[model samples]
Target: MATFQIEGGHQLKGEIRPQGAKNEALQILCAVLMTDEKVYIDNIPNIRDVNKLIEILSNLGVKIQKLGQGSFSFKSDALYLDYLESEKFKEEGSSLRGSIMIVGALLGRFGKGYIPRPGGDKIGRRRLDTHFGGFIKLGAKFRYNKEERFYGVEAPNGLKGVDMLLEEASVTGTANILMAAVLAKGKTSIYNAACEPYIQQLCKMLNSMGAKIKGIGSNLLHIEGVEKLSGCKHTVLPDMIEIGSWIGLAAMTKSELTIKDVSWKDLGIIPETFRKLGITVEKVGDDIHIPEHKSGYEVTSFIDGSIMNISDAPWPGFTPDLLSIILVVATQARGSVLIHQKMFESRLFFVDKLIDMGAKIILCDPHRATVIGHDFESQLKATTMSSPDIRAGISLLIAALSAKGVSTIHNIEQIDRGYEDIDGRLRAIGAKITRFD
Candidate 1:
């Protein structure tokens, strides 16, 4: 278990470039299996989860080559189908939540797919019903092995497109179904689909590779079945979650940091969400400049003078992933704010750690938290803690950076699963963080 020993109470000042979108990278990496031609991808982040997926693809006989830094070429002309049934594959596939995506591509191209119960952040109940349900709708026979916790889908005669309405606008679910639909026999119409930027990127990338997909940035997606897909070059967007994290880190630690090439147009409601917490978010040539909040930030009240409430919704609304950072930033703000995490039940449980550090916080329940800011009149006392999930881990690291003394965070592998070389990146920005392996 790796740990991070952070010497707190220091201001960071420098420019940091956000890495490629992790969520998008997962979908894009899986899409390579849909084509036999060479598909070149750029701006892929070297994080643990993404690397694990790439390793799985390589083990499945996909010819992968590193063209350059954060770039790769993949050719899936042949695949080891038998490997999908192997114990080694079950162990590898179950360990990564993103591995479920590969099943869609494999099913679309090879007529069959199998995956173990996938694992990821222990934030809440992340069900795979949406993924499997979408597959069944596309003419695939679904079976589950409760003893082994395994899922299998097979369409021996190839998939046929169908019009279906998704129960939830799940990003991964939509991507999986969309990938399968592109190769189906008829037109597929998806209603109430997730319209996140990552989904749009996947749609556009698929279109570029001979797929007839319409409604790039909307809820309804129409896909015209194509006989074959050809490979094409694609570049991933910068991670909006990481950009949001940097914004929170700047406000909490009173640092003046500039986040470079943030794709400001794609960052809907993120900068504005931070602004609601009284942080200055300036647009400097496609970059986000977060000024130091030496005088402390204030939470903006509602028009009716009610208590400020920050909640997560689907895209075009605030993202749930950043709500943890928002909760941490609200600790030193001028007023109180209620953080309602509608998507997950266990994310708010990490507030107890912040309360231990002298912050005024009320764990309203498993889904909500009420934070009463100390207004910088009281600084959080450093303490040793353990990371719970990727978002919570980064949120705790932000708290540690702003606390009074040295703080130790155990199980930093949770943090590394998402962020790429986070300690090295923070160090470049004048942060006093040391890592112990």
Candidate 2:
């Protein structure tokens, strides 16, 4: 395990280029299993989850080559799907939720797939019912062996597309079905699907590879099955979640940080949501500059002309993954704001740690909380803490970095699973942070 030791109250000032989208890269990497042609991917983030996924692919006989920084070429000319029964396969596949998508891609290409129970942040009960439901709708038969904790799926007559509406707008579920549908027979109409930026990027990349997909950015998608797909080069988009993390880090540390090459158009309601917390983000031609001044910061209201309660939804709304960071930033702002994390029940449990650090916050419920900025200047005593999830881990890091004294954060592997060289990036901006093994 690794820990981050931070000397707090240092203003971070510099420009940082955000990494590629982790979610998008994982989906695209799995999509490579659908074809044996060479696929080149650029701007892939160097994170633990991605490396683990690559290892899984290599074990399956997929040849991967690292050409340069953030660039790689992958070819699956001789993939072996039977490796799913190996202990190495189960161990690596169970480490991240994204591994579940491998089932769809493998089944699409090889007509059979097997995987163990996937693992990820224990935020709440993240059900795989939607994913398997979508697979079943595509003419795949699924069976689970609880004693071995493994699930298998087979498509004998090949996947036949059908019209179906997802019970929940699950992101991975939509991606799984879309990948399977791309190589299926007949047209697939997916209504009430998740159309997040990652899904849209997946659709675009598949289209570039000869897949016919309509309604790229909407919930309703029409995928026409293609007989075959060839290799193509695609660059992953900059991570919007990471951009949100940087915004929170800049505001909490009271720093003048400039984020470059950000996809500002993809930031649907992020700027407006941050403005509510009294943070003014300036757009300078593909760059977002956060000035280092904190005198007149106040929470802005909603479009209905009332005090807004920020919450998470499926898409085109504030992301559930970023709500923790937003809550942390609210502690240093000028006014009160309500954070409603409707997607997860235990995400707000970290507010107790913030409360111990002299932050004025009230935990309204498991799903909602009201934070009143105390602006407390006292030194936050050094304490030992464990990370809960990816976003919460980074949120705690931001709080520890902005505190008055040194704080030790344990289980930094959770943070590393997402952010690439986080300490190095923060150090470049004058953040007094160190990592210890």
Candidate 3:
């Protein structure tokens, strides 16, 4: 197995370009199937999950040509509907959860869709009910093969757009439903939809492809169904999760790092969120400069002096994906904060590893963690550990970078699935992390 041998206590100083958005790439790549014409996509992150999805699309007969680095031209004119029912497709689909979007596209174009039980991070029960439930609400016949663990959706009469109020503001669910509704028979209004940057990007791209979608940043989206969608060129935004990771890494290790070309206007409330933790983030043109902390980096309490609390919610709130990074950053801060991860149930379990590194944290429950900071007085003692999920894996890597002594993190494939060239990028910034067996 591959592992990362990180030598901590070294300060990183340099500018690093954040990768293209991985989450958006997943949705966009799947959206390429919405058209039979040549669809050109630039700024695609060449990571494991996206590569796997590309592999799946190739097996289904999509003609994909590498236009250049981080760019691809896809033509779905030769798409094979029968390939989705094959055993090989099932094996590939089970590797990543984002593969489920393929089903929505297939159902839209061919009146049928098939997928195996999708696989992703083991953070919690990421139920697919929201996705399939929306499909059923759209007049599709749904069936689950319990013995073979397969899901099938068929709209033999063709899909008719209907108003859907999703149970939760699920990101992928909203994307899947929106993709399906783009070519439906009528208008589809989605209430409580996920308005994440990725979702908004997907909507804009869809509209460029001839789909009429309203309400760009709001929770309610109105999609006017079209007979067919055409090809369009789309460039993905910078990875917000990666931007947040760099912010936490800069603070945790007391380094000065500049995240380049982050598309400042799109990063809603992310910069201010870090400033609340006493990290000095300066905006130079369009880049984010995080300078090294020279004094006490304390958590700013609420106006009434209550212990600061950071929690995850839908869009416009702190993302749940970066809560682990926040937890690690808080370990070296000057004050306490309660991290409430309300979205995922088991994401906060990684705090045990942080406590073992000498950070003070309390596992209030599966959803909440109270972290008491030491203001860099107590250093983290590094040891070997395994990465649980993609976000948590990077968070641990950041913690290991700041800990004293040599730390080894196994199962780094989880980290590589999302981050593009992470070790190489860190090395450019003077981070002492190497991938080894």
Candidate 4:
């Protein structure tokens, strides 16, 4: 129940490195379960969800060693199969949605995977149909109990790969199915699969571990089952969502900041998407630089002079995870933009908090918000608020950093589930933010 008390109006200027990707870390940690040898992973983000996943792995008897800060070596040779059915596992694993990936990894290794209905933010209905459906398509028996709300998949006769098309390009679903298919009996072709950098990185990591997977950055992936996979070292890319957040924060608060080691090649349409919101994001080698804005940036209108619409879609489209930050930054821009958060229904509701802070915004619906820029003419006034989820939480923090007076935010535990040491990092760059009991 810790809270953040932020003294607004500080001009941040310094270099800050984004943490390892949280989304990728989740899949990579689960991928370790596919091999029995020691898997060494570097640049792992020290965050809550990752720690919880590691705890679950430790409880399952996966030998884990902390090599150093943000580095770990994992060996699954000593896994206790019986622990999958333990009440302790169900209680802990269900706390985060990433734990669902463990099921697919277990199915790939031992022909069985079980988990209670997984837990995560109440942003919307994040269905598991895609995951279980993918498993069933690959010769696994999928069962769900209505009373207990448990999901279980088993392939006692061993899994045989089958061509499958996902209902949607669900990222976690793609990872789960890809993991399951890697050790199955035949070639598996997945069309309309998610090709986000996280998923592509998983393919590369799996291939390094001796799994045969083609299509590194495309919607179609082909996996040829191998007898087994071996361990390998993996270094995670920087957190793109965090990089986007820092961009928004720099623009909103008139700060100059440099985000280091972003792996720009993997950031598809992210930097350009921020530039569309009137922020100046420059590519300096592998880093992203945002210069302080004396004259606030203005949103660019379409060629037809109509109101700009920023909507999210699958890979190559603007990321839904960043729509919240864009909406917050648009509040201070010189022009208006309609933020269409198509992926998650309840994400735009956080605009109410911004409106309270003296921003002009309209919650058009659950899925869309229209923000009219104040351009610092009407500066935001600080207020008390609670963080809803990871993206929205960071958005609120960005708003607070740009407001007048002080702002106190609660439920930062939701923020910590994603970002790594956000307050400490902000403090290093001259943000007056502190954590308290």
Candidate 5:
């Protein structure tokens, strides 16, 4: 295990470029299995989950080459479908939830797929029922063994597309079914689909590869099955989540930082959500500049002409993944704000740590909290703590960096699962952080 030691109260200042989207790069890599020709993908973030998926793909006989920094070219010449049953496959498959995507790609290309139960942040009960339900609608039969914790699927007669309305707006579920539907025999209409930027990017990539897809940014998607697809070059959009993380860092530390290559158009309600907490971000020619300010920023009211209550929802709304960081920033703001994390039950559990550090917060319930900014300037006593999830890990890191004393963060691997060289990048901007085993 690894830990991060931080000597706090340093202003981070520099121009830091955001990495490629981790969520998008994972599915894009899996999409290569849908085609037989070579594909070149640029701006692939070098992170643990991405590297793990690359190894999994290579084991399935996909030829992968590192072209340069955050670039790769992959070709799936001969895919071994049965390799999913190997020990290496099972080990890698159980490591992350993204591995479940291989199920859809394998079944689309080879008519058979197998995967063990996937693992990821223990936020709540993230069901795979939507994914399997979508696969079944595409003419596939599934069998699972609870004792062995493995799932297998086969479609010998080829997939036949049909209309599907997902029970919930699941992002990965939408991507999985969209990839499978592209090669089916007929048109597939998916309603109540997740239309996040990652899903939209996947649709765009598939369209470029000869797949006919409509409704790129809406809740409804219509995919026309294709006989075959060829390789094409595509560049991933900048990671909005990473950009949001940096924004939170800048606000919490009261520092001036400029984030370049930000896809401001794709930000949707992100900038608005942060603006409510009194964080002023300026957009300058595709770049977001966060200027230095005092700690006690004011909270803005809602559009209905009332006090604002921020929450998460599907696309075109605030993302649940960012609410954790938002809460950290809210602690230093001037007014009270309500945070409702409707997607996950346990995400608000970390606020206890923030409260212990002298912030005035009230946990309304498992799904909501009311935070009254304490503006505590007294030195925060450093303590040992373990990271719980990717977003929460980064949130804790931001809190630790802004605290007044030394703090040791354990299980930094959770943080590394998303952010790339976070300590190094933060250190380059005058942050006092060190990583050690």
Candidate 6:
């Protein structure tokens, strides 16, 4: 296990660039399996989960090459299909939730896919029904090996597209089904699909690879089956979640930081959502400039003078991933705000760590929290803690950075799973953090 030792109450300066989107990279990396031609990808994040998925692909005989920093080339012409049934694959595949996506691409190009029960952050019940259900709707037979806790989907005659309405706009589910539908026999229409930027990027990448897809930024998607797909080069967008984290970090520590090349147009509701807590999110070209909150920030009340409430919704709404960061930032604001995490049940449980650090927070339930800011009247006293998940881990790191003393965080591998070289990046910007392996 790795740990982070951070000295708090220090103002960090200088600019930092957000890494490539982790969620998008997971989906896009799986999509590479849909073609036998060489596919080039740029801006890949050097993270744990993404690297695990890449290793899984390489084990399946995909010819992978490192072109440069954050760039790679992949060719899946000679895949080792038998490897999918191996015990080594089961161990590797089960370790990453993103590995579920490879099943769709495999089923599309090879007619069958099998996987061990995937694992990821234990935030809540993350069901795999959406992914398998979508596959079943598209003419694949589903089977489960309860003894082994494994899942398999197969279509001997290949998948045939059909019109279906998704139960929820699950992002990974939508990506998986969309990848399968691209090589299906007929037109597939998916309604109530996730329209997040990650999904949009995947759709565009598939289109470039000769797959017919429409509805780039909407809930409904239409994909026409093609004989086969060709290779295409793609670049991932900067991670919006990381950008939002930096915004919260700048405010809580009263630091003036410039987040470079943030892709403002794609950051729907993120900037405005931070502004609701009275944090200044300025637009300077493609960058986000967050000035020092020297006097502290105040939470804006509702028009009816009711208490402020912030919640997560589907695309174009506030992202649930950043709600943890928002809750941490609200701890030092001038007023109170309610954070409702509608998507996950257990994300709010990490508030206890903040409570231990002297922040005033009411854990109303598993899904909601009410934060009462300290307004800088009292500083958080740092202490030892353990990271729970990727989002919560980053949230705790932010709280530690703004605290009054040294803090030790265990299980930092959870943090490394998403953020690329986080401690090094923070150190570049004057953050007092050290990593011990």
Scored by lDDT, the top model is 6
lDDT of each: 0.95, 0.88, 0.92, 0.92, 0.89, 0.96
Model 5 agreement with the true structure over 168-237: per-residue lDDT tens digits? 9999999998988998899999999999999999999999999999999999999989888899999998
Model 2, residue 125: what's the lDDT?
82
The deviation in Å at residue 125 for candidate 2 is 0.6
Per-prediction CA RMSD (Å): 0.7, 1.4, 0.9, 0.8, 1.3, 0.6
Residue 137, candidate 5: how far off, in angstroms?
0.9
Q: List the residue pairs that clash in candidate 6.
A: none
lDDT of 2 by residue, 159-185 (tens): 998999999989998998899899999
TM-score of each: 0.99, 0.97, 0.99, 0.99, 0.98, 0.99
lDDT for each residue of candidate 1 in 1-437, tens digit (9 for 90 to 100): 99999999999999999999999999999999999999999999999999999999999999999999899999999989899999999999999999999889988888899999999988889988888899999999999999999999999999999999999989999999999999999999999899999999999999999999998899999999999999999999999999999999999999999999999999999999999999999999999998878799999999999999999998888999999999999999999999999998998888889999999999988998899999999999999999999999999999999999999999999999999999999999999999999
Better model by lDDT: candidate 1 vs candidate 6: 6
- Candidate 3 regions exceeding 4 Å error are none
lDDT comparison, 2 vs 5, better candidate: 5
| TM-score (C-alpha) between model 5 and the true structure | 0.98
Q: Is candidate 2 or candidate 6 better by TM-score?
A: 6
Model 3, position 404: C-alpha lDDT score: 99
Query: How many backbone clashes can be found in candidate 4?
Result: 0
Choose 2 or 4, whichever is better by lDDT.
4
Comparing 5 and 6 by TM-score, which wins?
6
| Clashes found in each candidate (C-alpha, N, C closer than 3 A) | 0, 0, 0, 0, 0, 0
lDDT of 3 by residue, 300-360 (tens): 9999999999999888888888888888899999999999999899999988888889999
Clashing pairs in 2: none
